[model samples]
Target: MLPFRFIHAADLHLDSPFAGMSGLTDRVRKHLQQSTFIALDRMVQLAVREKVDFVVISGDVYDSSNTSLRAQLRFMEALEMLDREHIPVFIIHGNHDPLDSPRLAVTLPPLVHVFGPVPESVTVVRRRDGQEVSVITGMSYLTSKVKENISLRYNKKAGASELFHIGLLHANVDGNQEHETYAPCSKKDLNTAGYHYWALGHIHSRRTLQESPYIVYPGNIQGRNIRETGPKGCYLVDVDETGAVAMDFRELDTVRWFDMEVSIGDCRHPEDLRLNVERLLTDISESYTTGFSMVRIRITGRGSIHRELEDGFILEDLLIDLRRKVDNQAGTVGFAGCVWVESFCLSSGAEIQLETLLQEDSFIGELLRLAETELAGDIGSDSVIGHALRPLMDQPEIRLLLTGSTREEQREWLRRAMELTALLLLDDQEAGGASA
Candidate 1:
């Protein structure tokens, strides 16, 4: 039996910038760029700590189609650490890093083996106590887009003398909606391949399809954005001679991604909003091991403060204050900053006197009718009256003015419409107040 273990990891989108993201501090940007190397370093450390026999990187080692020489060198240097520890490394070219690229010219460590695009496997012979163990495998990408099922290519069984059979593939594996449908295949396709373990990649989230044959995705070593939030890392697998497998998830990410939603429904003033934000940050910072963290806070829900929060600079200031609080509480947790506020709704209980306005056969009634009709068609449409009148109506401040008991309730609907209008016009300010 081969008395050794292996680490499987993939999708290291190194040095990829969050281009469309806004409201980020300069420190956050720098940390993101440096996180790639940090993750790589952690992987190497894990391999050395466990004294694993080999490490397999499924694909997407670099973020660019044309990788820089500097990045290539740094990557090789990190791998050299593993080579120095007398451990071998196996690499497969993913969709991002397809074979036949001449940009990578750095001399790799002798212990490292990089598989080409063709589906071929090299046997690794390990000797322990005068006994030899042979591991057979096949891997490759063939083309940028391997539309036809590639799992069928590995149907042939391994030799009887082979101690372990493994297949390293960069495939979509039965059409995952969350990922690009690259090399698609069914579970039956993999089961019939006769491989004891299939190290799969392409998807950014870690998943274990089956434990019997051990089909797994180590996920991306690090999360790149808000969409890819949660604990991101690699997998450590220990397979015995009898084909019994044991797997454990090991976190290797230096930077973490978190998405937080703070509802301002009860926030009547800017200070209330600030207090809510501070409380949320405090909770998040306490939950994480790393004092330094990056957060994307989404201000949501209907509230009176929605109009004040629409101001770009004012919202930015709120984020700054939240960051300051987190920094003060836990000096190590770095706030990457906040995300764009999706929408702030004003649910104040106040109604527009449409009956009074229409009693005089005024334009306000006609405008209200048009808005109601458009809203009926599609309440989300930009042409809704609330959206149309935002620019003309000006009420920057929020006030508690009520007359009729039910009048307040009626005005709330008008406020909501005004809120929607403000969003449509991109006013980033409050609309006119409703009169009971």
Candidate 2:
């Protein structure tokens, strides 16, 4: 067996319409939209630099079947670079971009090959030296919904004297519950397929189902939301002359998504908390000077400023100020990319004692007791929460906003409402006592 190296990438998701972002500057939004294309370019650049024999994308080359012309043109442009270097590119469409869907009349380069619906094998041959000993077997989805176990259909090509064999698939192996069970299969199916390596896709998180034959998912090229956080990229697999394999994971994301929880438990003032958040943002911006950061900041722990933050307008002001600071820093010489706060969630609790309030013979105590009874289901459907929230749930416009549907979830909502009501009652009592 001769030594060979190839790049394995999947879920490119080009021309993805990034949602949940509003009130962003034109520059920032433009950068967010171009992120996927940038990631693909980076992968192509890496392949050229490493001088890999070939590149295989398991599935999901585009976000949808109606992929934009810009995405198609950019994809072709990237592959053209690989073709110029004599590097072969193999691709298979996933559920997102099946063959049955309507697509633009876009053509690929001479060295590029897209696998059809039926299982087929293509041997990778080097143009300079005629070596076709490495065979790759793969198939694409004909339609968007593939409930069949496609991996079971793949088998090693017969009568092929190939030195190395690879299986390329975009499927949910072992019914990974996180994603839709399209083209589902199992580890046993792949392990017994007689392929030296399996390159997989569909799941957005990287994982290795088995190491013996190396069944791996390179994840997505770039994350589109906060749920898909951290570094996103592909794999570089190198097969040694002795058939021993070494795989290297590479980061190709141009815009990285991050989720951060900042604790203000030790801060005595709002100024202190502001400084802490600013400092953290500065560190992240300086660290990833080449890429943009979309961060979701969650404030946690008890703090004196918790009451102030509950005012709603204060949080809006804080977000505005933080974004202004980020924009200002972008003007600095070293800032190649800037950080944008996707959302600011306040989970900080108040510092008041709640046990004493529940014992009082006043409005706060009455409300708290009612909340406890309803939460325990002592009042049943006629409970205060049930009556008050029933109308809101009945309204079609507001129904979508209330996502919590379970009993425990209802209890949590009631509990939070009671806490806020108690705070107001306490303030009112203090004011009455001062006048009397």
Candidate 3:
């Protein structure tokens, strides 16, 4: 048996529009809109540069079934580049771009082989010897939803022992809760299939579950949102003559996404907070070579600025000022090329510590205890404060907000409310004292 090299990529999701984005400059928006194509182009370039024998796209070449003509043209151009170089491409459609999809109307090059609905094997011969070297067994999604365990149908053992066998699938393996359960199958199901390598798709986070008989998800070639943050790319896999397999990840994303939490526990004044924010943005910019990045920051921990942040006006003004500072530093040294803040949150608590105040035997302390009891449900639903929010909580939107919320999160919210109320009262007292 001879050694071979190939790329296993999936979830191209071409021409996917950014979701829940705001405050973008026209220049940034343009780059984002074309990021998917840019990522795919880089993959093709990598394939050519590395001189791999063939390329395997596990699934989701397009964003949806009704993919735009522009997307199709761009995809064709990339594949054509490989075709001109005499490199072959194997593809299988996932639930996003099923076999019956109307968007697959565009014609592709001869070197491209798209697998059909049923599990079937296609043998490729080594160009050097004209002898069969590898067999690729795959199946495409016929419809949008395949509830059955489709892995049961793959028959890789039908191939001869001397050939390398590869299995391609776009399924929700082992009931991955992050993604919709489409074409569900267990890891055991794939392992038992007796393939040398299993190329998987549908979940957009890369994982190499097994090394002996590589079961891999190369993730999506592009990260479309914050949830899909970090490096996005494919796997360059090499199989040696002795059947030893090795895989290396190659990053293809032009724009990187990051979420950071900046603590303001020691920030005693607004200027102190401003300096802290400036430091954070400056540090983040220099951390990545990608140059362009999207960031979401949460300002957390107890601080003197908590009351001001809760006032809304101060937070809005602070955000505007922070953006101005960041915009001025775009393309400058010690900063990511063009960094954009998606949104910010003030999760800070008041300077007055809640734990210390809880120990007092006073009216305010009693109120704090009551609030904590209601928050923890220690005061049952029969209590006055428990029923106070019951009607509001009954609303559909409110219930939706509470859905999947942990007890810690609920308690945290309650603590924030108590802190805010106490701060307001203290501010009122100070005003009264000054007037007197």
Candidate 4:
């Protein structure tokens, strides 16, 4: 067998709009909107530059079944570029972009092969070339919800011993709770399967579960939100003549997302907090000098600013100020590039003793006590607090982000929220001003 190289990527979710953020400059928004396409373009450029034999995208090319024309056209153009370079592309649709879903009328290049609903194998072949045959076998989603274990259906197709076999699938392995249980299977199932490599998708976090047979998920090409933060990209897999595989992760995101918590435990005033935020923004900007940053600034730990932030409008005002005084300046990312504060949260606690407050006999005390009992009951979703979170949990994508949260975590948050609510309701203007 001859040594060959290829790029592996998945979970494009192209044209997916970024949301739940504010104070975004016009230029930042524009950069965010084009980030997905830029990521794909980078992948194609990498494929051509590395001279890879083939490219494999495990699944979820579009964010929805009703794929946008812009996403389709951009994806098509990337394929055309690879076609010109004579690099083959193999893709399979996941739960988000199933085989039964309707898409715009756009045709891809001949070098692109989109796998069908059932498990099937396709060979990597180019005319006037002499190399051992390698096959890519994959299956796509028939519908958005696939619960049955379909990994059992795949096997190394009856072919010559010299052929290299690669398995591709967009499924949940071993019931990973962070994502919906779709096309669930165990690692053992994949281990027993007679394939040289398993390309997996459906989980948005890149993971390489096995190295001997090379089971991998390249994650989404772009991080769409704070929950999907940090560097996002694909894997450039190089295989030796002996079929030994080595993978190198290449970052391709044009806009990075960040959620940073700045603790004011030792701070006394708002000015101190401002200095901390400036330092954070500087670090974020320096870390990703080549692109833009969408940051969610969370102010945590006990501080005198807690009482001031209880006004609700104070947080809003701080958010506006952060945007104006934030990186790049005047609604533009300058030549040096910068970060934008997408959202602001004041999760800081009051300097007053929590135990003293909880022991009180007032409405605030009762509220805090109930937060640990009735509010945290099993009928949480039916309660007021749960009702408020219903909207976020209703959306599949947002729910997926919350899927990892446990009841204890929710209860702890409920207590903190109740504490903040109690502070907001009280008109204590001087209780914590000693530190302010």
- TM-score between candidate 2 and the true structure: 0.87
lDDT tens digits by residue: candidate 2, 1-436: 7788899999999989897777676666777788899899899999989989999999999999887788888888998999999999999999998988776677788999999999999988754576775899999999999999999999898877447889999999999988999998998999888888999999999888888888999999999999898889999999987778899999999888889988779778878887878777777788777888888888888778888777877668878887776666665542355787888877777777678877888777878887877778842457676577777877876776565365555565676677788878888889999999
Worst 10 residues of 2 by lDDT: 328-337
Which sequence of candidate numbers ranks them by TM-score, best first? Answer: 2, 3, 4, 1
All candidates' TM-scores? Answer: 0.75, 0.87, 0.87, 0.84
Tell me which of candidates 3 and 4 scores higher on TM-score.
Answer: 3
Cα shift from native, residue 171, model 4 (Å):
0.7
| Higher-lDDT candidate of 1 and 4 | 4
Which of the predicted structures, 1 or 4, would earn the higher TM-score when compared with the native? Answer: 4
Candidate 4 lDDT over residue span 6-118, tens digit each: 88899999998776656566766777788899899998888888878899999999998888889888888888999998888999999999988877666778888998888
The total of clashing pairs for model 3 equals 3
Q: How large an RMSD does model 4 have?
A: 5.4
Per residue, candidate 1 scores C-alpha lDDT tens digits across 1-436 of 6655788888877666656765545555666677777888889999989877778888878775677666677788888999998778888877776675456556789988888656766666442232344354556564466677777877444464456777888888878988888878988899987777888889998899997677898899888776687788899888776767888999877667677777877877878977876677567656655524566776767666666665556667766665555444433534333222212232332223444543545445555556555535532326554364455345434222222224335445554664454344333322332221
Q: In model 1, where do residues sit more than 4 Å from their true spots? A: 1-3, 126-136, 311-313, 323-436
On lDDT, who's better, 3 or 4? 3
Any idea what lDDT model 3 has?
0.83
